[model samples]
Target: MPPQSEVEPYAAIRRDARSGMSGRALERKYNVGRRTVVKAIASAWPQPRKKPPPRPSKLDPFKPVIDEILRKDLDAPRKQRNTVKRIFARLIDEHSMSDVS
Candidate 1:
């Protein structure tokens, strides 16, 4: 997000543009981006998009290996159900993968 110091000028720019101010003149007067001036002329309200959070799990990098192990376990005996610990262990044993916590 940009500082209010910068964002605060948008309203004034939009106001000027709304009253028949040209995009080029708005750009020159406000010293904002050309796109910003154009958007200001098009609409009075600003709608800045909020970014979603990133999701990275320790298990993410090893999804294929985990999926294969779990798929194979589906055919195994009832007593051989795969657990989180077992999955981690199998990953360690088979892939020499030790990056996970």
Candidate 2:
């Protein structure tokens, strides 16, 4: 059989407990923690996981320079246009972007 979702177990735990199942029994039955059993009894749905705040990237400072290079390339012929390799080289040599790979 397919694995149950995060929700199905919580609903099952609540229903089983209502029929006079102990907290320890619920934990053993569901293969979940004591806190998980308590949480299930408290609420129908599980609390959403918290997300970490976004961090700045090394390329943040050089984004405008890259954009300008791309914009200028729009006027150039396809063969003469700035490639990724060329861009990286320009950043390192011209802009001194040695820190970023």
Residue-level lDDT of model 1, residues 1-101, one tens digit each, is: 85575356778887886698888888888887898876765666676778989878877778998898889989999898899898888889888787776
lDDT score, candidate 1: 0.80
Q: How do all models score by TM-score? A: 0.45, 0.82
Model 1 residue 52 lDDT?
A: 89
> How many Å off is the CA of 12 in candidate 2?
0.7
Per-model tally of clashing residue pairs: 0, 0
Against the reference, the lDDT scores of all candidates come to 0.80, 0.94
Output the worst ten-in-a-row residue range by lDDT, candidate 1: 2-11
Q: Show pairs that collide, candidate 2.
A: none
List residue ranges in candidate 1 displaced over 4 A. Answer: 1-46, 52-58
Location of the lowest summed lDDT over 10 successive residues in candidate 2? 92-101
Measured by TM-score, the strongest candidate is 2
